[model samples]
Target: MSSHLLPNLTAAHLFEAILAIALVFSCLLGLQVIRERRPPAVTLAWVAVLVLLPMLGVLLYLLFGTRKRWELRVRQRPVIGCETAVRPFDDAHVLDRMLRRLALPPALSGNDIRCSWRPEVARRDLLDVIDGATERLWMFIYMFEDDASGALVLDALIAAASRGVRVRVMVDDLGSFGSLAAGRRALEAAGGRMVRFKPVWYALRKRMLNLRNHRKIVVADGQVAWTGGRNVGDHYLAAGKHEWLDFSAVIRGPTALALEEICRNDWRFASDEPPDSSPVWVSGPQGNACLQVLPAGPEYRDDAWQTALVKCCFEAHSRLWLATPYFVPDETVTNAVLTAARSGVDVRILVPHRSDNLVVDLVGRSFLREVQRAGGKVFRYKIGMMHAKAVLVDDTLAMFGSANIDARSLFLNYECMVIGYDAETVIPVQAFFEYAFARASRGVRTIGQIRETLSSLARLLAPLL
Candidate 1:
């Protein structure tokens, strides 16, 4: 019948139109990828997703594959020609040369580093420093809760602001959205400035839901700074039922100026406020610690943390000990660790037994067998969640800050770490590792059937973790 033929023709035309639209969209996406010029592996992965999954793949890419904002990129351009003004104690180490090549501020000596592993002690020190702030106070925390401990910090900031102290607070949009209104209102009402770093709505609008500023930095009066894995919250500070074993370092010296500069750059990027180019360099050395600050994130063309960490693994002749709550290292890191361990390096990785992220916990377990096979040791902390992020190489080198041993931290998140080549700074972090190792249960190559199955499935999605 003519009527049936017409209906069939119409349906076929509609299907053809849909297919054409999809093809056009895929081509456009491919072109955009080419323009961005990402790494071959990342580009291929994205292209494969687009080709295989069509609309859904494109949607996922839109949500997660975008780069850092143009504003941030522009702001960081000056670092390219920035000279390393400070100098390290030993310029002989290959690490120092690598850092200098990256255009990082020189490794400065005469810095004092005090580390605290106990939650209450760390919080006490943090609050004390805040209370003692005189000139300027800047805090960039990923999570700023309104709970008991958080309230104390907030009140301290408010009081400091009221007393004419310059205070600026920056928190991650998604991580601390619940505290946004209250925190801003409390701080602004007291004359302090506050801004959310890359708000979630901004990310959604820009189709960039993956990048987050996860740094926890506190700089007071440009004289001292505190930073590490701990955020501003009751769980991270107080002795709660589910307390975490966290570590923070209080640093004083010219290194504090380096930390203050990091906070200033981040604050200016988020607020678009006039740059604070005021010098905060100390007139004299505060101690004898040699420290180099490494600020890593998606803004840079190269992954600073990844490069440094890989070099740290490969260059270690004696020992390499690392600790983090998450351990989903990329293939490069994994291979480097395996190669180093097999070469008789005392490579050890410490992770928490009970992690805050279930997927990360499961996926982390999958790497244990391979590491063990390479003669490396994996230790699981039985003590509450160990949220410390630290690295110890031999006896003179140590690093600690907000980075994790995972793809997200290494390549996605805005993170910072201080690399110290002095025993004064490295010794405490090494001691902390020793303490955690003493309380850790050495990894077994096998696990229960159910967990093993879950972990196997989780490891399949490790790249996304």
Candidate 2:
């Protein structure tokens, strides 16, 4: 019926096959060379996938590449009635009493911030006040494992929702990739709303790998709030039977208003329903505490946390204390710490003895030499991963929130932090420094020489962690 047409079709198919095969082969080689300096195992795994399943492999890499932060461009409406709105708490004494919830500075730009290290205490206190707020609840987490303790938190929220609380939860789709879908189903069935951040689909539209919402925050009654490193997973509270050292806090007053605003902004960007803090919590007779809320993300022009830390370190009158699970120092941070130590400032850094991410762990160790040489002290927690991000400056200024001392925290992830100038708060935070140091392993680096030959190359690539 058509020998000529059949021959043409055959020729076209053969050409298509050759071009597709050749294209994939070139992509595989390119990935290999680009990853030549990475850990051998990591590079090999990356190569194998791209070569064996070029389409799917490239898609996977684009979704979860070696990027430290990931985000999107979405315009957001400002929160009205934001507690952070400039206002005076009716009774100076009353506002001061509520401000006591936070370790505030004498004053703040808009609102103040207070930090609580007792994760459970913060959660319980916030919930007690949220008991009858049957309007709404929203939460986001980087990870959500199916564990008993995690279930407990879920149950509580679900119970609240059942009682007419509008509960909505969003989890990092890629972070909890390996979990069974049934886990999320439980929340959905319990009258809670659930969604995943960037679930993988077919190919294309993948390259935005560096953006991730590593923020942990909870808002109840749109008045009280909690934000920190504590995710909704059980391992955070030792509920997974392997709880190590983790920290979080309860922040209220004006700063809490900003906290609520920030969370609502995020929710708006994600679900297209911008949040409005109508009748938002207002500052009452709170103590005269100076507190500032710090929130940063990919769209931010400057890393506020990093700037504050650098300032704190350089201005330390006597001592500085920092607790972080990961430690990947950037140039400015490294210099500030060094200068502070050299200036006779007692500088102490607490990092997890073992880190969840190996790449960052090595980079942290790599910077030890320079830190010690400058008279700074580096201590590794022995009991467990020291997952507390606390910076007590001069025993007079204190900061706590989601940001770490690492580059990821400084520039990559969506992080929140609060700084205050209060001895009452800073003193308690610094007092615990000794206990942490007691449980930490001092670095082997000699004074002034940061010899981290072990991971120089790794640190070089960490700009991508």
Instruction: Please report the candidate that would top TM-score against the real structure.
Output: 1
In candidate 1, which residue ranges exceed 4 Å CA deviation? 1-22, 31-42, 68-71, 74-85, 88-92, 277-282, 445-457
Q: Clashes in each model (backbone N, CA, C under 3 Å)? A: 1, 31
lDDT of 1 by residue, 1-465 (tens): 999799999999998898777767877887777666554556777888878876776788788877545446524322221233355426446787887687666687777889988889889889877888998899999999888889888988999999988999999998888776876888999999999988888888777679999999998987789898999987899987778888898988777877887888888778968986543446367777888889888666667898999999988889999898999887788888899899999989999877889877768878867788789999999978999999999887999999998888887899999898878878899889989999989985587789778777777676677
Worst 10 residues of 2 by lDDT: 97-106
Which residue segments of model 2 deviate by more than 4 Å? Answer: 1-132, 201-206, 239-241, 274-283, 286-288, 445-452
lDDT of the candidates, in the order given: 0.83, 0.64
What is residue 416's positional error in candidate 1, in angstroms? 0.6
Q: How many backbone clashes does candidate 2 have?
A: 31
TM for every model, in the order presented, reads: 0.90, 0.74
